[model samples]
Target: MALWIYRRLPGAGAAPRPVHLAHRIGGAVLLVLSLPIAYHCITAYGVQMDSARVALHSLAGCFFYGAFAAKVLIVRSRHLPGWALPLAGGTLVTLIAILWSSAALWQLAQP
Candidate 1:
């Protein structure tokens, strides 16, 4: 749906934009906020057994990830500056690493 909207919108399909430094910084902040919540959810896994808490944290993390992806798209569209791409990529990679590590730890802790 979002891809369709972007394609339909004027100027959105033209070219890949670079991400701005500020936008990259914002993405980093979002990634930081999401990491802890994601870690908590992963660490808890089946141990906590609190569906509500897990759901809320997962939703929040999803929102943060969505924002991060949007920033990446904006950067890719050349709307942002070129220098920030590395930062954006680093932030995304770190988020994935943290999520994976936390999940692995959680699994090890279980049973």
Candidate 2:
């Protein structure tokens, strides 16, 4: 996120090829590392909406992948508007934050 923001800054100039490479590598690593957690969540509890918090977490979890797909598509497309990739990336990040707060933090707060 910080790298994306830095790249977006007005005076930051064009990001070097290595920076873009690093960003892609980081995203791939995050996706690979998240698979086990996603599998556990889906197999263990499925999509429970028994409470508001659970519902938010479940919905965000579901949307995160869709957003990821969109971002990947945006990255690969040649004709998309300039803002499209950033918008997709931002949405994914927001969903991650929501999921972390709604699920992980909630679990940590349990007695």
Evaluated at residue 20, the lDDT of candidate 1 is 41
Model 2, residue 49: what's the lDDT?
81
Off by over 4 Å in 2: 1-6
- Identify the candidate with maximal TM-score: 2
For model 2 the local lDDT of residue 82 reads 82
lDDT of 1 at 40: 73
Question: In model 1, where do residues sit more than 4 Å from their true spots?
Answer: 1-60, 109-111
Error of 1 at 54 (Å): 7.4
RMSD of each: 11.6, 2.2
Candidate 1 structure quality by residue, lDDT tens digits, 62-111:
54476477656855586667556556656656655655554556568789
Each model's total of backbone clashes: 12, 0
**What would the per-residue lDDT of candidate 2 be over residues 18-84, giving only the tens digit for each residue?**
7777888989999999989999999999999899999999889889999998999988999999888
Q: Alpha-carbon error at 102 in model 2, in Å?
A: 0.4
| TM-scores of all predicted structures | 0.37, 0.86
